[model samples]
Target: MWNTLVSIFPYAIAYTIPMLMTSLGGLYSERSGVTNLGLEGLMLVGYFASAITIKMTEATLGINALPVGLLVGVAAGAIFSLLHAFASINLRADQVISGTAINMLAAALTVYLARTISGSGNVRIMMGIIRKNVPFLSKIPIIGPLFFSQSYWTTWVCLIIWALSWILLYKTSFGLRLRACGEHPSAVASAGINVHKMRYFGVTMSGALAGLGGSVILITYSGEFNGTVAGLGFLSIAALIFGQWKPLGILGATFFFGIATTIANVSQVIPSLQVIPPVFFKIFPYVATLLALVLFSKNSAAPKAIGEPF
Candidate 1:
C-alpha cells in the first residue's frame, strides 16, 4: 500500500500544481473586488497556445518545445485576460458579465484559431521532447519518487508563485493597498490611492497567474490542446471560494482537489480498487466541489466591498 501510494504521488503533485496556480489567480482577482468568472476562458487560451506552440516549434525548430510552449501559453492567457480587465476595470462594466463575455470569446477564439492554424481543433506533440529529472535530489527514496518522478517545471514554478503570492498578500505594503482597494475602494481612494489602478493591477495579475495555470496543464498534463482545460478553470474558482481568498488557504484547497482528481483518474488502474467504476471515480472531484460549496458558503466571506465598481 505504501509503495502504491508513493508511486502515485507525482501524479497528485502534477494535478495540484495547475489548480494551485489557478486558485492563486482567483485569490488575486477576488481579493481586489473582481469576480473572475472568465478563468475558464483564460485557461483555454493558455491550453491551446501551449499545445500549438509545442507542436509548431517541434516541427519548425526541431528542438525542445516546452519552454517556448509555456511562454506562449502564458502570453496567450495574459492577453486574453487583458480584455477582461479592460471591460471590468477600465470600462466599468459588470464584472460577472465581463468575465462571461471573456469566457465565450476565448472558447470561440480558441476553437476557430485551432481549426484554422492546425487544420483540426486538436493539437498533439510527441512525448520525450523535453524531459528533465531533478539532479541529485531525484535519487532520494520515497520523497524523490513521489515528487521528482515524472513531474514538469510547472510544479516548481507553482511553488515559487505560491510563496511569492504569500509574501505579496501578507507581508507587503502593496498587498495591503490591494486588499484595501478591494474591501473598501472609497476608503482607499480617500487615502490618496488610485482605486481603479489597484483593481486593474490585481485583475491583470490574476489573469497572468491563471494563464500560468493553463500553461502547466498544457505542458505537464495534456501535452496538447483540447477542451479539457475549461472545467479546471471553473474548479479553480471554486477552490478560491473554498479557501476564502487566502493564498495559503487556496493552495491547500487546490491540493485537496488535486488529490481527489488524481485518485479519480487512477482508481480504475488500482487492482484493489477495481470494483469502483471509472464513471463514479470521475465524478468524485465534482462531488467534492459541491460538498465544499455547501459547507463553506455560510462561513466563507468575501471582501468588504467586493463586486462594487470603483
Candidate 2:
C-alpha cells in the first residue's frame, strides 16, 4: 500500500499544479468580466512553443533549455491571445465565438507549425529535465515522503504562484477594482477606472498563466508536445467553476480533480482495483467531471458580467 501510494500520489500532485494554474487563469478573466473559453487553445500554443524551444535549443543551452523554454511558452500564449482580446474586447464580438475561433486556430496552427519547424509530425522535448527532492524538508517523516520527495521544481513554483494569486485577487486594492469590473463595469467606469484596461489585463493574464500551466504539464509529466493538451485546459475550466471562482477554492478543486484524473492508471497498478474493466477506468475521470458539474453547477455563482462584452 505504501509503495502504491508513493507511485500515485506524486503524479497526482504533478497533475494538480497544471489545473490549479490554469483554473487561476480562468478566474482572472472571469473576474474582470471577460469570458475566456479559449484556454485550451492558449495552452496548446504554450505547450507547443515551449517544447519546440527546448528541442531546438538543446545543443546550445544544454541544462538551461527548459527554464528559457518556459518563458517562450508564456510569451507565445500571450501573443496568440491578442486575437481573442481584440475581437472580444475591442470589436465587441461574441465572446464565446471569439474564444471558439481561438481554440480551433490553436489546434491547427500548433500542429502545422510543429511539423514545419521540426520536419516531422510531433514536437518532443527531452533534455536536462529536473526532478529533485527538497533539501531539509525531505527529511521529515511520512509527510516528507509524500510531498517533498520525487517532485519537480515546477511544483514549488506553481504553489508560490497560487499563494501570490490569492493575495493579488483578494488582498490588494487593484483586486477590488478588478472584481468590481466584473460585477458592474459601468460603475467601475463611472469611478474613473479604465474598465477596458482592466479587462485587457485580466484576459492577457489568463493566457499567460494558462500557457505557463501547459508548459508545466509538458516539462513535468508529458515531455512531448503532440499539438494537443489532452483536454487538460478544458478540465481547468471545469476546475475553475468547481472552485466557485475563488483562489483557495480553485486549489481544492484542482487537487480533487487531479486525483480523479490519475485513478485509471493508479487502479491498474493497485492489486485491489485491477478487477474492474480498464475501459471504465479510462472513462471514469471525465464521467466524474460531468457528474460533479451536475451536482455543483446549480449552486455556482459566477461573476455577473463574465460573458458580457463591456
Candidate 3:
C-alpha cells in the first residue's frame, strides 16, 4: 500500500492542480455573489484555446509555446466569462440561466471552431511542461518524495497563486469588500463602494483562473483538447461547495477528489485495486459530492446574496 501510494502520489497531485485552480476560481465568483455555473464552459474554452495556440506555435516557438498557449487560454476564458458577467451583473438576468447559456455556447462553439481549424473536433499538442524534482527538498524523508519529487513547474506556480489568493481574499480590505458584495450588496453600496465593479472583478478572476485550469490539463497530463474537461470543471464546483468556500478547505477537497480520480484511472493495473469494481471508483467523487451537498446545503457558508443581481 505504501509503495502504491508513493508511485501514484505525483499523478494525484497532477490531477489535483487543475481542479484546484478551477475550484479556486469558483470560490472567487461565488464569494462575490455570482453563481458561475459556466465554469465547465470556461474551462473548455481555455482547453481549446491552449491546444490550438500550442499546435500552431510549437514548431516555431518550441517549448516557449507552452506559456504562450496558457496565456491565450486565460485570455479566452476571461473574455468568454464576460458574457456571463454582463448578463448577470448588467442585464440582471437570472444568473443560473446566464451561466447555463455560457456552458452551452462554449460546448458547441469550441467543437465547431476546432473542426474548422483542424478538420476535427480535437487538437493535440506536441509538448508539455516537463516534470522535475526539487533538488535537496526531494531528498527529505517521506514528505519530500510525495510533495517535491517529479513535480511540474506549474504546480508550484499554481500553489503560489492559491496562497496569494487566500491572502487577497481573507487578509485585505479589498477582499472584505468583495465578500461583502455577495453578503450584502446594498450595505456595500451604501458604504459608497461599487458592488457591480467588485462582482465583475470576481467573475473575471474566476474566468481567468478557470482558463488556467483548462490549459493546465492540456499541457500536463491530457496533451490534447477534445472539447471537454471530462466534467472536472463541474467537479471543481462540487469541491467548492464541499470545501465550504474557503481556500484551505478547497485545497483539501480537491486533493481528495484528485486522489480518488487517480485511483479510478489506475485501478485496472493495480492488483489490489483490481479486485474492486472500477465503477465504484468512477462514481466515488460524484456520489461523495451529492452526499456532501445533501448534508451541508442548509448550513452552507456560501455567500448570502449569491446568484442575486445587485
Candidate 4:
C-alpha cells in the first residue's frame, strides 16, 4: 500500500499544481467582487499560447523551449485578462456577462489560433521540458518522494504563489483594501481608494494566475495542447468554492481534487483495486463539485458588493 501510494504521489502533485493555480485565480477575482466566469476560456488561451510559443521557439531558435513557453503563457494570460478588466471594470458592464463573453471569446480564439498554428486543433511539444524533482530535499525519506521528489516547477511555483496570496490577502494593507473594495466598494471609494482600479487589478491578477495554470498543464503534465484543458477551468472554479475562497483553503481543496483525479486515472494499474471501475473514479471530481456547490451555495458568503459596479 505504501509503495503504491508513493508511486502515484508525484502525479497527484502535478495535477494539484494547475488546479491550485486556477483556484487561486478564482479567489482573486471573486474576492474582489467580480464573478470571473471566464476562467475556462482564459485557461484555454494560455494553453494555446504556451504550446504555440514553445513549438515556434523550438522550431526557430533551437533554444530551451520551457522558458519561452512560460513567458508566453504568462503574457497571454495577462493580456487576455486585461480584456476582461476593461469590459467589466472600465465599462462597468455586468461582471457575470463580461466574464461569460471573455470565456467565449477565449475559447473561440484559442481553437482558431491552434488550428492556424498547428494546421490542426492540437499542438504537441517536444525537447524542452519542465521536469519534476526537488533540489537536495528530494533525497529525504518516504515523505520526500511523496512531496518533494519528481515535482515540476509548476508545483513549486504554485506553492510560492499560494503563500504570497495568503500573505497578500490576510496580512497586507493592499489585500485589506482589495477585500474592502469587494465587500464595500462605496466605503472603499469614500476612503479615497480607486475601486475600479482595484477591481481591474484583481481581475487581471486572476487571469494571469489562470494562464499560469494553463501553461503548467501544457509544459508539465500533458506536454501538449488540445481541447483537454476545457473542463479544468470549471473544476478550478469548483475548487475555489470548495476552498471557501481562502488561499490556504484552496490548496487543500486542490489536493483533495488532485488525489481523486489521480485515483481515477490510475485505478486500473493497482492490482489490489482492480475491482473498482475506472469510469466511476473518473467522475469523482465532478460529482464532488456538484455536491460542494449544492451544499455551499446557500451558506457561502461572497463579498457584499461583489458583482456590483463601484
lDDT of model 4 at residue 117?
A: 75
Clashes of each: 0, 0, 0, 2
Best by TM-score: 3
Q: Per-prediction RMSD in angstroms?
A: 2.2, 1.8, 1.0, 1.9
Q: What CA RMSD would candidate 3 show?
A: 1.0
Q: Which portions of model 1 show Cα errors greater than 4 Å?
A: 60-64, 127-133, 139-141, 275-281, 293-299
Instruction: Provide the overall lDDT of each model, using Cα atoms, as 2-decimal numbers.
Output: 0.79, 0.86, 0.93, 0.82
Give per-residue CA lDDT, model 4, range 1-310, as digits (tens): 9998888898888888887888888888888888888888888878889888888788776656777787788789978998888888878888788888988888778878888877888899885444657787878897777898777766776798889899998899999999888788888899999988888888888888888889889888788888558588888888887777888778888898888888888888898867988877667777886787788787765677777776
* Candidate 4: C-alpha lDDT: 0.82
In model 1, the Cα lDDT at residue 39 comes to 90
Q: What's the distance in Å from true for residue 183, model 3? A: 0.7
Task: List the candidates' TM-scores in order.
Answer: 0.91, 0.94, 0.98, 0.93
Better of 2 and 4 by TM-score: 2
User: For model 1, what is the error of residue 165's alpha carbon versus the real structure, in angstroms, after optimal superposition?
Assistant: 1.6
lDDT of 3: 0.93
Error of 4 at 286 (Å): 3.4
Predicted candidate 2 versus true structure: per-residue lDDT over 1-310, tens digit per residue? 7877777888899989988888898999999999999999999988988998899898899878988999898888888888888898899999999999999999999899888898776887766456788899988988888899889998998899889988888999999999998999999999999998999989998998889998988888898888788888888888887777899888988888787767775776678768885678556556765776788777756898887887
Residue pairs clashing, model 4: 132-151, 133-151
lDDT of each residue in 1-310, candidate 1, tens digit only: 7877876777788888888887888788888888799998888888888887788778666546777877787788877788888888778789899899988888888889888988888877775324457878889987777677666766877798799889988899899999988788888899898988888777877777777788787777676777557488888887787777888778887887777777777887789767877777556656766777788777657787777788
